[model samples]
Target: MTAPSGTTPNPLEALRAKLAAEPAVVDAAAPVVDAATLEDDYIVCHCTNVTAGELRGLIHEAGCSSLEEIQRCTRAGGSCGKCVPLLTEVVSIELGRAGIA
Candidate 1:
């Protein structure tokens, strides 16, 4: 493509060259969430002050079979909507372990 025969120069290539000269950027390390053991994962919800351990305990103590049951007993999903999925996952794992699935 001859740029209609009269354009002096292309601008895209110049912009690309400028960007290529910049230093490489690095990302900061993120904290790990275990999601397996009850002690390592971060439970952002604190209404129940429920840690992963306490959630596991609730499953055993209340015989919670579903996410709603766990939520009702511990208020894990009562406050914020963020941690509900995680709590559900943990409860599922606990129920599976207890042969209740």
Candidate 2:
């Protein structure tokens, strides 16, 4: 392609080429996680504004092995509920990576 006469490669295309060359930095838009572990480790916290780190910490501190126990110990699913789905997704992804899910 002529790149629109005077223009360089499309900014997006250039960025994609750069990213493709670097395997260390994952594309934020596409998080990679295992499927089976996600099913077991995912937790939707509707309360306490908790994140994956908080959930993981609670799980570790409380010696809990399940999401339900995590909720009970940390009150993470006890709030506005807007972030619950995100929380669940983060937990699933992280746990999958950790081989715990």
Candidate 3:
């Protein structure tokens, strides 16, 4: 791999590697829940206690169209970063529901 051609590992790359290696984070066979049926108390990020409703609000009301914006607003995937993919899925659903591009 040529040692990544750098003296120090990139933080973002390191995070990506960690997430990729985390098996318990997400299961491919697990069923995905429809965003439309989620209640306000339905937690999307357990590490940060963020709910689907909050994410919906961020998308619909605050106009957060990207995962970066959502993270900055509520720190959903800031902890272990495991909820990132699911959080992203939920964000897309909410955006689609709100008719935002």
Candidate 4:
């Protein structure tokens, strides 16, 4: 079946497109933490051995703005899916720290 007009081929792609189109309104006064400088040693997903640093890399470098995208890129929450919550938190923290929102 064909996708609806103006809609992306898939939800994930749609999300990625939307995120890419968004204007990053960073507060000039707020301190922006470089993703590379983030010292993320804690492992968020043990099933995949995905550390917080790795996930941050996906966000900062790979431009993954959502948890699903991160999972697709790194298989972090793809195993038992138990670490989805923590992964979500990590994504939020990294995004905020990086001043993406």
Candidate 5:
């Protein structure tokens, strides 16, 4: 797309405008909840009823390294897929603790 007349459109300005149009989409200062701080019993994938402890067992005992391996073993994020991010975070925490992240 060409800019109007001789004026140049700043890409950053367009990006900022687009982002601003979306309400409460992002909080730059908000802290991310740490997956490591959650208890082992905490449900990381509600769809599969998989807990943090199970993920840890997969990572530490079973030596599962990736989310795909975990999914194949336990079917955590197979349905709906909403819990995938939390599952990933839990996996990341477990892998990080095991020095594999």
Candidate 6:
């Protein structure tokens, strides 16, 4: 099969070929976390019944920058304020993931 004109071959194919020619290397200490197993729908704030997905959406889509703003938007940490820390952590994770902070 002919490659597209003026284009290079697939870099992934090249890597596969190179790996096929090399000895198998095993690293038992490598960290493995199943992303699918990660909880996203758990209630972050029982007072408002806000889920992690909802908080993440607020941070990403609504552009919430702080826990206060998140509280204003989603009423997450507005009650007993026990979930403020978790709310703050969620905001940090979401904003960092979006490269906003």
Quick one: best lDDT, which candidate?
5
lDDT, candidate 5, 9-67, per-residue tens: 88988878877887576653333567778788988777889988899999999999888
For model 3, the stretches where C-alpha displacement exceeds 4 angstroms are: 1-32
Model 5 RMSD in Å is: 9.1
lDDT value, candidate 4, whole model: 0.74
After superposing candidate 6, which stretches have Cα over 4 Å from the reference? 1-38
The digit string of per-residue lDDT tens for model 6 on 16-78 reads: 888888969875333233322337786778899998888778877877777677788888878
lDDT of 1 by residue, 23-77 (tens): 6775332223445665634563566677876767767776667777777767776
Candidate 6 whole-model C-alpha lDDT, 0 to 1 = 0.72
Question: Candidate 3 at 65: error in angstroms?
Answer: 1.9
Superior by lDDT: candidate 3 or candidate 4: 3
lDDT of 3 by residue, 7-94 (tens): 7767787777777787466575343776567888899899989998899888988888887889998999899877777788888778
Q: What is the lDDT of residue 48 in candidate 3?
A: 87
Model 4 per-residue lDDT tens digits across residues 12-78: 7777778888867865433344333546786778899888888888888878877777788888878
RMSD of each: 9.0, 9.8, 12.1, 16.2, 9.1, 15.7
Candidate 2 to truth, TM = 0.41
For candidate 5, give the lDDT. Answer: 0.82
Q: After superposing candidate 5 on the true structure, give the runs of residues whose Cα lies further than 4 Å from its correct spot.
A: 1-33
C-alpha local distance difference test of each model: 0.66, 0.56, 0.80, 0.74, 0.82, 0.72
Candidates 2 and 3, the one with greater lDDT = 3
User: What residue pairs clash in candidate 2, if any at all?
Assistant: 47-77, 47-78, 47-79
Better of 3 and 6 by lDDT: 3
Count of residue pairs whose backbone atoms collide, per candidate: 0, 3, 0, 0, 0, 0
Of the pair 2 and 6, which is ahead by TM-score?
6
- Top TM-score hit: 5
TM-score of 6: 0.57
- 1-57: candidate 2 lDDT, tens digit per residue: 237877777888877777788768545433354323344334444345454556666
TM-score of each: 0.57, 0.41, 0.63, 0.55, 0.65, 0.57
